[model samples]
Target: MADLHRQNEHGSRNRTRFPTQPTPSAPAPELRGHGLRLRPWDAECDTDVETWLRGNSDPEFRRWNTPVKLVDGMEDARESLRLRAEWDAEGKCVSYCVTDAATGAPLGHIGVNDIDHFIRTARVGYWVLPEARGHGVATRALRLAARWAFTNLGTHRLELGHALGHDASCRIAERCGFLYEGTLRGAMFDAGRHDAFRDVHLHARLATDPEPGEGEGKGE
Candidate 1:
């Protein structure tokens, strides 16, 4: 297994080959699983992405996620575009916009962050839209993303961390086959306040782990 802490600061290897320009020529590749599909983020589909983010980033969702300040209409889409651009340039991290294959509508967002090519591991983070919650969108999205990372980027392990008290997220991690390694004390701050940070549960799925079945898998 690859070291999980190695950092990839330079874009020297394992770069993803995505077209610089948005192409409507073909539908985004579908990552099919238990009744779900995960695909790369499409700026052309910004309308859907914006709608999902705007509708879901309410106080309820913000309870866990860092507060997002949106400027005007479509700012979220613009930010998504910028992040993709960074992904292209950095050659390390990648993000995807999750959607329902049957309907091609946006359901959520997931990404591999803090990627370390030398170690061939990356951290996973995700959020599902309000209406799409409890329907296994996050699990499906995470499974697909992990598979892609391991297959395409030569990743050996995927790591996930969830705040303490996030029972739902903890369940997701366990269901997805991640081992609860341990937690970090005061590891993260939420909502701009340094609340007593709960022990973050760390979980990892190795490349040698059985190929994730085609279905909704879990990661917090």
Candidate 2:
């Protein structure tokens, strides 16, 4: 299972065939709700490049996530965003730059990745910037992205995994109605180390699961 996860593909006995209707609806619509707007990451935009670099290079974010190709500097950040945009173009993932709905300032990142429409499942991950910590930015972004995934991608299941001790992320998952599923041993690279591995606490939410309460703003 861990190996399959690493490949970004899920194996299922169901053998069901779902139409390739291009999940994520292509071009990735802006998801606005609850004082947050999730827009696609743009490599050509300077603001996107700076925020992408800052967020991805942040100590706190690196403590949890290690991209397959590390963003080492400004050019790397632009390339990273370029890859995200390309992945979305290929309908393999939908990445978003989470920002304040009113101010349009980048506050974090959230992505519904490895979308398998036939299996109707995808993985989700997020990080809150230092300035945005303790303000529920991650929670809000997760909910908005989840809602968008289910609606636009027809995604039946969304999976979230965090390092075993990431209690804050676990709580955010729970708050968004993603119930604890199980632990995947050595499912991810250990914090700041590509050579070591760490266990991941898995959580999942079904399309039919009860929705989280609507908070401050209406969905768009």
TM-score of each: 0.74, 0.87
Per-prediction backbone clash count: 1, 0
Clashing pairs in 2: none
Candidate 2: regions farther than 4 A off: 1-25, 214-220
Q: Output the lDDT of residue 28, model 1.
A: 33
Worst 10 residues of 2 by lDDT: 211-220
- Clash total of candidate 2: 0
Q: lDDT (0-100) at residue 46 of candidate 1? A: 60
lDDT of 2 by residue, 144-207 (tens): 9998888767899999999999888888888888999899999999887889999999999999
Report the error of model 1 at residue 36, Å. Answer: 2.3
Report residue 124 deviation for candidate 1 (angstroms).
Answer: 0.6
Candidate 1, residue 174: CA error in Å? 0.9
